[model samples]
Target: MTYKSDSHIRNPEDFGKVVVIYGGNSNEREISLESGQSVLSSLKKSGIDAFGWDPNQESIKYILNQDIDRAFIALHGANGEDGRIQGLLDFLNIPFTGSGMFSSAIAMSKVLSKKIFLEHNLPTPKFKVIRTLKDLKKATDIFGFPIVLKPNSEGSSLGMSKISKLNELEDAYKAATEFDDVLLAEEFIQGKEITVTILKNKTLPTIRVKTNRTFYDYFAKYKSNKTEYICPGTSDISEEKIYADIALEAFEALHCRGWGRVDFMCEKNSIPKILEINTVPGMTKKSLVPMSAQCKGINFETLCWTILETSF
Candidate 1:
């Protein structure tokens, strides 16, 4: 049986073959809903048996409580993207899409990720994770002004602030704590903001984010209409290839599976530095992964189906 909805694609066959785990009691509920809809649409189109589940408080119980062979995770932020839910799925012996617990954990924490990147000789922005305002002055002096303060374990640019003066450090720290305790202040790199989507060790393409805003904060990332995305970034094939290779290598180093997206910052030299990795990237209409995939002839629906097929 085929059923079509507002998203795109056919309904899943072999009903109950796969279950899509989505939504949660997280603040990013709207994005999660959009992601869930996209996944549901694609899963259905692929003729697979899949259904959507919120997995709210008792997510583990929710999965085991139901008859689900496999899970396609569509949740974002905190409980969903932070590896807690992935760990639950693992314990339940349920094969789920996206990276495993360890990978998700590393990707979730910015402080830990930068440490790993440095140890692995991967180019990443120098950052300091300050636990209190006492360490703020020291960190700022080292990283210098124009620092980006964000939660160590948050995504979607939530609780992110750019401080160019010492007086703003306190406010930035306070705002960042709204998301997580250890606040990360990275040396604000003045360059192009790039996003790379990878699947099966293959980096799709380089997407350069252009926004009228100062940095690609929450507004520029999710809300602002002033931002423009160039799928391939530039006409320079050499730079694009370099970014793609670096992104693929970074993805492999992080032990990501199936599909993921990496964010990078490129300096004037065209050197792309690792910003972070998104295990369960957004699949909404304006998401970077889908946009990058579409550049290579894969629509949002097909890109999602490919991820499902590859993951399980």
Candidate 2:
């Protein structure tokens, strides 16, 4: 099931008409547009009959009329990644890349994903759900200073904040709640940030993220040129195996299929703590998944074609 290339697909015509869905009315629309463009260009370069569709500019009904055989989801956040579009495509009987509706719904909610991870005995940071000032107070008492506050359901670190004192709690909560009514307060694991990319149930080389900023925020993810990415995240083979194993376990536990990315925070000599699962990760030039694939000798076009095969 390891999709290293398009070896199984002898001809691009077999793919039929493909639609790269992206740019929904989500806060991550800009990122999604870039990702969708990248994927669409790659598909065309590979001779696949591909077209880009932006939900914000058009309607879902229009896609049905266009005779799109399958979809390559490049959208992120809200309607795109929260299972709404997946469900719609399922009802229309069109296969799409990435997880099913149920899995997508669960993974979109950080709170729900954490519950599944804990149920499987997976290592994840301690967290508390916050809906009010009182809930934030309770969480601060448990996690103390330098706690991470983020929207319960968001991506690209859109509404995430790290607070180190009581005075910063309200501002952080307000910021996160701007994206989602519910928020998550997690224990800030002081360690290296690494991400694992999974394609067709196979793990790609891990990438360790380094940034001079306080943490890898939206700026560092897509905008910052100073950010450094170290492939094979850890030098030790055993440690790399640990990250890959945990990533696969987490992906399966959530019933996520196709391609995805699992992020982690690893403290020295400590087990890596799961951050969150990205069902439809970014596909822009600066994306981490492509970076990991490149380390394994899989070019971006090949990677895009392999992901499209998942719809089959």
Considering every candidate listed, which one attains the maximal lDDT?
2
Give the poorly placed runs of model 2, Cα more than 4 Å off.
1-7
Model 1, range 70-156, lDDT digits (tens) per residue? 678888988777888788877777667788888898888888888888888889988888889878788888988888888888888
Pairs of colliding residues, candidate 2: none
Q: Please write out the lDDT profile of model 2 over residues 156-228, one tens digit for every residue.
A: 9988999998998888888898999999999999999999999989899999999999899999998899999
Count the clashes in each prediction. Answer: 7, 0
Instruction: Score each candidate by Cα lDDT.
Output: 0.79, 0.92
lDDT of 2: 0.92
Model 2, residue 179: displacement in angstroms?
0.3
